[model samples]
Target: MIIGYVTNFNLNQLDFNIKLKIQSDKFISSNCRKQYVKYLLDFEFRKNFHCIGIPIIKDPPKDSFVIGHHFFNDQENRKIGSYIFSYCFEKRHYVNLPDFTFNTLLILSHPKSGMLHFKDRNKRILFIKPKPKYISLCTSREDICGPIFMKQKANIIKKIDIEVDDNCEIGDNCICKNKTLKESENDLKFIYFVPKNTN
Candidate 1:
């Protein structure tokens, strides 16, 4: 079954250089596609097929959320990051989820440059913590800034068709901080169906 969840909180920076207008055209399972995307945002891990976190559009024109992912070394330390955050689908309703709070959300800088970033549904900057010197399940690193968690709100909506002009992220292409995409290059189209009210 297909699932939807938030990918990166920071839109501008994640797409900083390669500016391929974010659109949900396909399923991006973890460590399968877009290798660099692993550095862009944080998501939970699953042993089976990988998950592609499509960008979490607050409220897309119609309705769409992020679903994209990329590759990591698939190492033993994988649990280290997983401890910080876990994927919450409707099925796996685990109570261990960090206490849902307000101040937890803060913003750091240059995540691809460092530890991690945490953003809320409204796209507000949440926490900006780094990997801990002495890591644990609830490490001091996240305690100070705030932990980054990948929360998913799902429904019967299954597949979303995405079409982008070019599928490229500005890794080395974007050298400068002040980069912009022209109108012609900013073509991202998405079309999907949501189940109608069953009442």
Candidate 2:
């Protein structure tokens, strides 16, 4: 879907000097105009410069800049036809919000979680949730840490345990490829830990 932020101003309301970039299948609608106004006045959301929208179309470009949905339909109800993502970078700096909103059918191809976990300088663990429609990897590293993965500038040392289904794959290029296992219906429920966790 075309994901981007929105504001209270209409196409005409915006000052001429202020520039907005609207991508394909994304536009401002009349139904949410007033809601955008109230959002601008809201104290809780004041810290956020841009208010995002969940577009109708599915599979929008990465980091596509968009605006002008005005007000979100239901901000309090976190699950309103929208998916929420929380991302943590360098063991800290968490970013969470509605991915994107626009005026087209939003067919979520991947159910991947935007959140990720990393260990050591070159080691990392990625958690993904897949959607029914698409087969591509749901989560991308850039979405969490921009373009490059830099370390040492900050010391991030933390440990956490995560659960996953037996059918899950680490990723096509994942170092954990050799760790894959095959289990039949007779396999018992269990948990396995990597060397890092055993330490």
Best by lDDT: 2
User: Ten consecutive residues with minimal summed lDDT in candidate 2?
Assistant: 133-142
Cα deviation of 142, candidate 2, in Å: 2.4
Residue-level lDDT tens digits of model 1 in 1-199: 3267867554453433421112132222332332112231233232221222223423222222222222222334342121112222332221121222111111122222222111121231122122111111112111121222222223211122223224234443321111331111012111111112112
- For all predicted structures, in order, the TM-scores are 0.17, 0.17
Clashes of each: 23, 19
Mark the regions of model 1 whose C-alpha exceeds 4 Å error after superposition: 1-36, 40-76, 80-155, 166-199
